[model samples]
Target chain A: MAVAEIKIELKKGVADPEGQNTKKALELLGFEGLRSVRSMKCFQVDIGLEGDEALKACQDMCRRLLANPVIQSYSVELK
Target chain B: MAVAEIKIELKKGVADPEGQNTKKALELLGFEGLRSVRSMKCFQVDIGLEGDEALKACQDMCRRLLANPVIQSYSVELK
Candidate 1:
């Protein structure tokens, strides 16, 4: 079996209101000294294959479907 | 300061198409023996204050803006 973990976030140049709100909320909650915050999405997939085949499929999915190369980047970890 | 960790997922009764696709993609990637896969969003925030003030703000943010209480749940930690 193959497991791929994908994380997606806004491009660095983009402004994220969600992330900003989260940071503000954290401060209000009593978490001081916080310097930065960001928002991200994560996906864990279990492929039914093994080795190279699974890795290839994950990359293809990332390119073709899971993410838009123009706005998002993903890293795949296979186990 | 207060740091709220919020995890949002589609309600159990809701079907998650994105998650399903990710599972399929993973199988194609070669990760075998995987039993379950899910998609989630994560946020990390550093609040700029300290103590009780921070905690309260975080909760308020979660309730007022960060998440829809009807669809999401969150946990908070303070340091």
Candidate 2:
């Protein structure tokens, strides 16, 4: 079997409201010296196959549905 | 400075609608051999501290805000 770990995150300069909110909340909760916080999405897909074929399938899945290429970027690691 | 990577994921037996939906969509799009899909939240936080102190702060953050103790589990890696 092949397992793919995909991480989808906003592109640089993209506004991340959830991240901003989290930072604010942390500050309010008295967490100190916080520089920044970024929040993103993660997906792990287990495929009943192996090798490049599994990698290719995961990339296609990301392009089609897992990410919005216009505002987000994604990386896939296969194991 | 310290960088903490936090990953929050649904515990086993927890319902994952997003993962389920992604799996179904992949199947509909004709991607084969998909065994399972799991989705999660990733947070990268930069703190103005280092070492064990930073790690402890991150663990506190996770317990206080980043994750829910009931259905989700979180792990933090600090560097």
Candidate 3:
């Protein structure tokens, strides 16, 4: 068995409200010097395949449902 | 500037509804041979510090607000 570690993140130039809010909250909490904050979602899935097969499956999954291709980019690593 | 890659994930035994739903949805989408799915939140923060100082700051952020000490665990990587 292998674990497909997938990460989905917004493309550059996209606005990240969640990250912005978090940064604002941190500043309010007295943590300064924060330039920017960007957020990503990660999914770890255990699959029955290994090596290239697992990686391929995960990429397909990301394209199908895990990521928004229009505004987000995804990376998959099988281990 | 340095980027602090922060990851927040549920601790062992904590139920992850998001992961469960994704797995179920994938199965419905005809994805077979899947065993399990786990989800994590990642934050990329640009800080004015570097190396150990940056790593320490991110840890402090996680302790103060980014992570829920009770049910979630966090990791910080400086790059």
Per-residue alpha-carbon lDDT of candidate 3 for residues A1-79, written as tens digits (9 for 90 to 100): 8998899999998888999999999899888899998989999999899899889889999999999998999999877
Candidate structures ordered by DockQ, highest first: 2, 3, 1
Q: Which 10-residue span in candidate 2 chain A carries the lowest summed lDDT? A: A49-58
Candidate 1 vs candidate 3: the TM-score winner is 3
Worst 10 residues of 1 chain B by lDDT: B1-10
DockQ of candidate 1 compared with the true complex: 0.42
Q: Candidate 3: how large is its RMSD?
A: 1.1
Compose the digit string of candidate 3's lDDT tens values, residues B18-72. 9999999999988899999999999999988889989998999999999999999
Cα shift from native, residue A34, model 1 (Å): 1.4
- In model 3, the Cα lDDT at residue A39 comes to 87
Whole-model lDDT values for every prediction? 0.67, 0.92, 0.93
Clashes counted in candidate 1 amount to: 30
Worst 10 residues of 1 chain A by lDDT: A25-34
Share of native interface contacts recovered by each model: 0.78, 0.94, 0.94
Over the stretch A41-72, how does candidate 1's per-residue lDDT look in tens digits? 87766767678876776677677767877777
- Per-candidate chain B TM: 0.67, 0.93, 0.96
Cα lDDT tens digits for candidate 2, A1-79: 8789999999999999999999999999999889999999999999887889888778888899999999999998887
Q: Is the docking of candidate 3 incorrect, acceptable, medium or high quality?
A: high
Q: Please write out the lDDT profile of model 1 over residues B4-66, one tens digit for every residue.
A: 444455556566787877667656765445566678776655667566776666666567756
Which scores better on DockQ, 2 or 3? 2
